[model samples]
Target chain A: MKTSDFIERLAEALDAESSELEGETILDTLEGWDSLGHLATIAMVDELFGKTVSAMSLRRCRTVAELMDLACGEVTP
Target chain B: MGRVLEAQGASVTAVAGYVPQGRLCNEELSSRYPEWSAEDILRKTGIRTRAIAAPDECASDLAFEAAKKLINREDIDPEDVDLLIFCTQSPDYFLPTTSCILQERLGLSTQSMAFDLPLGCSGWVYGLSVARALLEAGEATTALLLTGDTYTRYVLPEDRNVAAIFGEAGAATLITKRSDLPGHGAIGPFVFGTDGTGAEALIVRGGASRHPQKRRRLEMDGPRIFEFCLRRIPGLVHALLEKAELDLDDVDLWVFHQANRFMLDRLRKKTGIREERFAWRLEEEGNTVSSTIPLTLESAVVSGQLKPGMRVGVVGFGVGYSWGAGLIEWTHGGMQ
Candidate 1:
């Protein structure tokens, strides 16, 4: 998936408008980025990529770009 | 060692379920968790209300009530029951196994065998499989399979992930042997899987041998559980269908453990099964741990969705990170 498309999907998963998200946006500062949002991201990643992403790994990501990198890394292999 | 005699066939004749009078609706939950609306909770979990056990109520108490209803409904004599299998994760006491307490409280014969099987979620199907084995072995003629848990008691009110999802309930099922030979609907070909590695994913880390003083509430990793279900259930169902020598279309109904609406829907889609063939009755009762499958079965029977002679595939998975599935040709008698 393209980096731009990943940002849009993450915004949708977090219930935020895509315009509000940027590659450098810190995930912790995002609205609706609570435990439920964490679950939604995991579901979205698995559904879209058929790859299992651990919540703990997502928790460690510093920015939207980092989250996208983690997802894309799994998809690559 | 020369000849092997065929064991008698066994099948469940009746199922009864009971949830306590108290209920926690999504509207109530919504007020507590402002971020999630009632519609959100309902949409995600397919649960509008969850039954809560009364303050003084215990797992055995709920089991007893369900057993009484089953006995009265089926006109079964308590004294005639040969074996009692009580499945639960929550017990009334640590000693004097809860099943033994049930035998005394329910007034079953002293000669009857009674024991507790400590399991959650995957328990009902596991209990059903055990009951069928005993009946087929001629060790028991009539068995009372009781599964109940007050998981609400273990979960802290503030824990949104598990608190809103689990409810308190109990179920009683009667499994009996028949003289007829086994055929299409006789219970067998059970497929079971367990992964102890994921045990910590859904657990109460207190009050057990290793952490007696911990006294912590229930903790769950929602993402991990969802991933586990997504990876495991579809394959489990297909394996069970193959083991039973039946195709997806041959099964009349599929009653999966009522975990959550989203997960169940995902499994249905992944398995390529139509919505109508799957059972999704957790709208009011929430996920009652081990009682889910039997509760769904009871509801299906009442609504005329499930009928005698129809092939039903029952699968239960969760908590022990354990899972079991079986195909039953719905029959009051074992087989014809």
Candidate 2:
């Protein structure tokens, strides 16, 4: 999946209707980006890609960029 | 003219259940994580403990197992069955109905009327009403209605708001075309009501027309859900009783949706129904969503608490902010 597509999906998953999320936008910055949203993100990733990310793997990432990198297999955390 | 079949005469053939391997109770989860609490879980949603589904298990998996068990009975001809219904808010997938998966697994006749009922907690009664209608219409001979939901899949463990109240489970009941002796009567005019204005009160933010799964995760308004339950259930109960032409005392048992201890107690007082008239399994099974009512029925029968010829008032109210109730009279030793 494309990084842009993942970002868009993340935005939709967080219920962020219309926000220009730049590269610098924090994952938790969006409204309703709570624990449920977080788990949904992980679930989406797992469902799309054949991999599992523990709660710790998500907790270690600080921003959306890190998550994208992790999703792409470029970073461990 | 076709005779109306009464619920009291019908038999519950079998009941089977499934839960996620990972188990977490309110106190255990609370003590493990300082941020969560028994009271916090209660205030958010009046649930003491809830079950989470295993990573590999899906809604259909649980449903299929329950149906399989119910079908295992020698009296049920698996090949001759004509209907399969799944009732739950948590489905295996958004598009293909979970019943399809269960239908395939159960090796049911391809011609069976297969579908899923996307309902909140009040689904069991809702499914029962649908099954009764189908049976009365003579459209199907044997119908399998399963209520299986994994609400924990929608919420996070840290969400004491929901973590404390929900339990994952599946229960199935086999309704057949049998008209002899006590097996036939009136299911009575069913009573159902909804408040879409309070829709936000008990909703999983993701996975539906309004919120859509692609949009977000489940988010619920705890106090609003509690208030909705407290304010509306008693009125609905009285109205349904009026429709059935029966007094509260005439009802043998009151099986309210097992939302929580607090909510059940509050509703008991408001409805002016004595606590003894109510049947419950909240403490042992937690809240098993739509499965609560049927599972409680099975439990009551096994424990010798309920016997044949007894009438019970069954009601459910939750998520979707929906409410429904039906009066059923038990037919003991009826299931072969």
Candidate 3:
């Protein structure tokens, strides 16, 4: 998946507007970044990328860019 | 280790289900968890209201009520029941087995065999398979398959994930021997799989011999468990259909274990089963663990969605990270 596409999906999963999410967007500041959003992000990654994202690692991500890197890193090779 | 008997056919003759009087509505939960509105709860979990077992109630109590309903509906004499299989994760006590207590409470004969199968959500199908096997082997002519659980008893009110989904319910199914002829209501050709690696994904970590702590409570890794189900169930269903030599169209109703609305919908979509063919009645009952399938079956029957002679596919998965699926021909007299 392209970086822009992944951002769009992540924003959708979090119920946030895609245009509002940038690489440097702080995840903790997002309004909808809760347990349900975490699950939705997991589902989106698994469904779209065919990869399982560890919830622990997802939690460690401070920025949307970090999450994108984590997800993209799994799908790259 | 064992010898096989002359195989006979087995059929589920009746099914009855019961829930406690207490109701936990989304409104109440929404009030408790401000982050989630009632609409959000319903949209996410597909449960608007769920039954909660009373503080004084135990798993056996729910089982007894369900059993009574079945016995009364079928006019079954408890003594006539040769085997009693009670499936539950939340037994009244760790010893003596809840089935033994049920035999006495339900007034079944002392000569009748009784035991407990400690399983969670996948339990009803597991219990049904066991009962059918015994009947098919001619070891018993009639069996009472009881499945019940009070998962809410273990849930911490503050735990939003489990509290939003798990509900308490009990079900009773009567399996009887039938002639070895191809006919409706005949039960068999089941597929079962277990992955113990996912055990901790949905578990109570602090109880039992391994973790004997008083503060034991249910903990779940929602994402991992969701991924596990997504990874496993579609293939399981297809494999069962292949083993049975039946296609998706051959089955009339698909009754899956009610884990949650979101999971069930995803599974239905993944398996390519049409929405109308899928049986989903969790809006009012939530996910009642083992009792969900049977309860859904009962609901389907009541609503006239299921009819006699229809082939129903039942799949149950969860909380052992275990799963089982099978086909059964519906023949309960009420449906007729």
Which candidate wins on lDDT? 3
Task: For candidate 3, write residues B118-177 as lDDT tens digits.
Answer: 988888888999999888777888899998888887889779888998888899988987
Worst 10 residues of 3 chain B by lDDT: B1-10
Candidate 2 residue-wise lDDT, B1-336, digit = tens:
753434332334445555556666667867866655566545434555566677788777777777776667535667787888899788878778888877888888887888899897889888888887877666776778898887777776555556666788888887665466454333545699888987776666665687554644466654456556655777788888898788999887888888777557656866889877888887645788898888777777776676767787889888887889988766643333
Flag regions of model 1 displaced more than 4 Å: A2-5, B1-6, B180-184, B332-336
Tens-place lDDT per residue, model 1, B241-266, is 89877899999899999988877877
Candidates, ranked, lDDT: 3, 1, 2
Which candidate, 1 or 2, has the higher lDDT? 1
Model 1 docking category: acceptable
Off by over 4 Å in 3: A1-6, A46-62, A69-77, B1-6, B180-182, B333-336
Model 2: runs farther than 4 Å from truth? A1-77, B1-14, B32-49, B182-186, B207-215, B334-336
**TM-score of every candidate:** 0.92, 0.73, 0.92
Report the CAPRI category for model 2. incorrect
Steric clash pairs (candidate 1): B185-B329
Under CAPRI classification, how is model 3 graded?
acceptable
Cα error, residue A54 of model 1, in Å, equals 3.1
DockQ of each: 0.47, 0.02, 0.44
Worst 10 residues of 2 chain B by lDDT: B3-12
